[model samples]
Target chain A: MLELTKEPFFGFSLCMFSYIIGIKINQKTKSALANPMIIAAIIIIAVLAVFKIPLENFMIGADFVAMFLAPATAALAVSMYRQFDVIKKNWLPIVVGCVVGAVSAVVSIVVLCKFLNMPQDITASLVPKSITTAIASKLSEQLGGIVPITLAAVLVTGIFGAISSPYLIKLFKIDNPIASGLAIGASCHALGTSKAIEIGEIEGTLSGIAVGLCGLVTVFIAIFL
Target chain B: MKLFKKTLILFVVCFISDIIAYFLPFPFPGSVLAMIITFLLLLSGLVKVRQIEPVSDFLVKNMAFVFLPSTVSIVSYLDVFQSILWQFLLICIVTTFITFVCTAYSVKLTVYLINKRKEKTENA
Candidate 1:
């Protein structure tokens, strides 16, 4: 069984199978909390913990899926490129909105970490939490953060964004989809975009567009910090 | 066929961007550099959006899958995370709300001003 897991196909298949199960559960529950990714992660973690599977073996099968992150992120340009017209008309607001979101996330995390006396490495790991995993993971490596913690932070942030965005929008009395979408994408990344998509197409498009922008903005801002 | 080709294009673009970032002074992540380069290419009409739409859509739609391994791998760090879990959770939740509200309000205010400026111009 250990050798089987070490095989390249094993991890990939495990993730795919888990995702399918997650999807089925989500479909049946029809609950936002039943997110497929979270469910899949929960299931995979449970299995790995139960078997005490070597992290190395699991990674052998899993790294291939992780590789998709780079190209997929680069591909974000295509979707946002389609939104070029909307971007053109509201470039000022859009740019400012993304900047605001990125700055707020990074700054708050740093400040909170300091206030709590969190260790430096952990603080660094949390820096890119609000960005998508593709970029956040890379940034964490550069910033010398623990990749796992950074990944956890990014996932938790995404899930929280997806779950809470609607209520936040309502409480803030934000009526415009553009406003809501910009906020969601900036704060939540892809997960947030998924929720935005459920609410409206324009919101979805704007939210998706914000993911790359927030990533880029966070990257540059992180450089300065 | 089309999706495969588009995906190849994105891959090639990313590969080239990585090479470029490797040689640059203070390289931002290659993925981000690739995204910017790709955006520029699309803007100049060098590459049509339709050409990459299929692959882009696939990758973005299934993004959560690619991230699954990393998220699940967190179990390995259980000892480290166990103590700080509540604080991490609190920060994640609070900051998300802060960023969300700040962004929405900023966009709303900015757009409102832009519209107001347009109205003034029209009236004049």
Candidate 2:
């Protein structure tokens, strides 16, 4: 009777162990399909369910880790700061790409939701789904959306971005490093940037820049419009 | 010690952004606001990149792990949230591709035009 659920180490160790395993599996496979976040989430949930641990118990220590999301997001500035030269050269394309990317994501979601006769609450949640989960979840709350639904949508969107971005670039024969990275980050956020970083330095820098730019664009769009 | 200072700087910036967003009618996500504010500060040379380097690297590199608590939240919403699962999932997948395509094409177009303008100037 360890009462593992009551102890803080239980949740913290569970997540760390799962994520570390996730990274290793991803490296061995050399595929984005086995995303570490998805893998870790599934493993953690299974462990909790198998032991019948209440979510409240798991969230205690896990909550401290989650608080990093905000500062981590703001850290996009560090990436931008590092790549000031690239950003300075391609400012217009970056801005335009992110704005267009945000608009297209929101518009297409609205159109599809309405076409499918989806409910308004669900639509509100889905509207900002293209943004990073941290910002999207907050936007979802502000728009009277189901926060979890929005988080789920944002994750799925990111997964699509990560798995499909390389394919998308190849299918379209996109050669411009700036354009490719910008597009991936604009659409995919951090998940896509991981792939971009694999491709080259230019794409990595631009993609990192795109994550923050698109987040800002989507937030303003979600809040004001 | 240095990491603490960097975190404090970012924390202060994030707090100010949160306050600004709170006063607005539209509830903007404060962290994103902080991101923009920080970006500007960096751009203006107000905050040197070296100042936040250590903390930012740790935060960004391990960003995926930070999402653990939120992703685990899926368990709580399994009942009410998944009612429209098919539609929501369908829309998410389709729009993601569409947005990706549009973003890439738009960036391509802008770069193309910029290159064309450069070519024309060189010719002149």
Candidate 3:
């Protein structure tokens, strides 16, 4: 059984199998917290721990899966282009909103982390927490952060935005769909955008646009940070 | 064959972006450079939507699956997470709300100001 772990096929198949199960569980539970990535990661980690399989062995095949990261990040252009018209019309508010959102996210994380005496590395990871995973992970790598922690921070931020946006909207008296959607995407990325889509078509579309724009803004901001 | 062609195009673009990133002074990400290039290509009518659609859609939809291994790597650093779990959770909650509220209001204010200027100009 331990020998099987050496084969790249073993790791690849295990990853696919676990993720499919994760998706199935998500479908059954219908809970926002039942994120397929979280479920799949837990399952894979548990299996490796139980079997005493070295992470290095698992990584041999996992590298193949990670190859898609670059292409997928680039493919974000397709969706961004689709929102070009809305962005053109509301470029002022969108640009201002994303810049504000990205700055606040980084500033708040740094301030809070410093106040709590969290280490510098963890603070770096949390700086990119509000963006999508692909861009966030890369930014984390660039900032000398631990990628896994960055992933964890991004996942939590996204879930929080998805769950709290509606209540936050009411609390703040935010009436415009565009404003609401931009806020959600800037704070939560795609996860919150899913909820925004449920709220309204315009909200969803604008939220989607915010994800890409906010990511771009944060990338430039990170260079200075 | 078509899927292969589209995937190849994306990979080729990624390859070019990687080269471009290598020549830059700053530690820019090649993947992001690829994103910008792809966006420009699409916007300028150099790359049609349908050309990249099928493969791009698959990659985006199943994106989480691709990152599972990276997430699994967290198992190696369990100690870091265990020590900072509470602080981490607090930061996430606090910062998410702060960013959300700030973005929402700034956008609202900008729109309001734009409309006010529009009204003033109309009267003039």
Which scores better on TM-score, 2 or 3? 3
Tens-digit lDDT track of model 1 for A120-203: 899889999999888998898888788889988887888889988889989999998899999999999988998999989878
Report the lDDT tens digits of candidate 1 across residue range B1-124.
8777888989999899899989977847898888898899999999888888878888877877888888887877889999798888988888888899999999999989998999999999
Candidate 2 lDDT over residue span B1-124, tens digit each:
8878999988888889889978977677788778778888988989988888788888888877888878888888887666887888899899988888889899999999998999999999
lDDT of 3 by residue, B29-77 (tens): 8899999999999999999989989999898899898889999999888
Model 2 residue B124 CA deviation (Å) reads 3.7
Interface C-alpha root-mean-square deviation of candidate 1: 1.7
Model 2's CAPRI class?
medium
Query: Please, what are the lDDT tens digits per residue for candidate 3 over residues A133-160?
Result: 9899999999999999999888888888
DockQ score for candidate 2: 0.68
DockQ of each: 0.73, 0.68, 0.88
Stretches off by above 4 angstroms in model 2 are A1-10, A24-30, B80-82
Note the B-chain TM-score for every model. 0.85, 0.85, 0.97
Worst 10 residues of 3 chain A by lDDT: A1-10
Winning candidate number (DockQ): 3
Q: Using lDDT as the measure, which candidate wins?
A: 3
lDDT of 2 by residue, A152-206 (tens): 8887888778888888899999989888998888787777888899889889888
| Candidate 3 Cα outliers beyond 4 Å, as residue runs | none
The CA root-mean-square deviation of candidate 2, after full C-alpha superposition on the true structure, stands at: 2.6
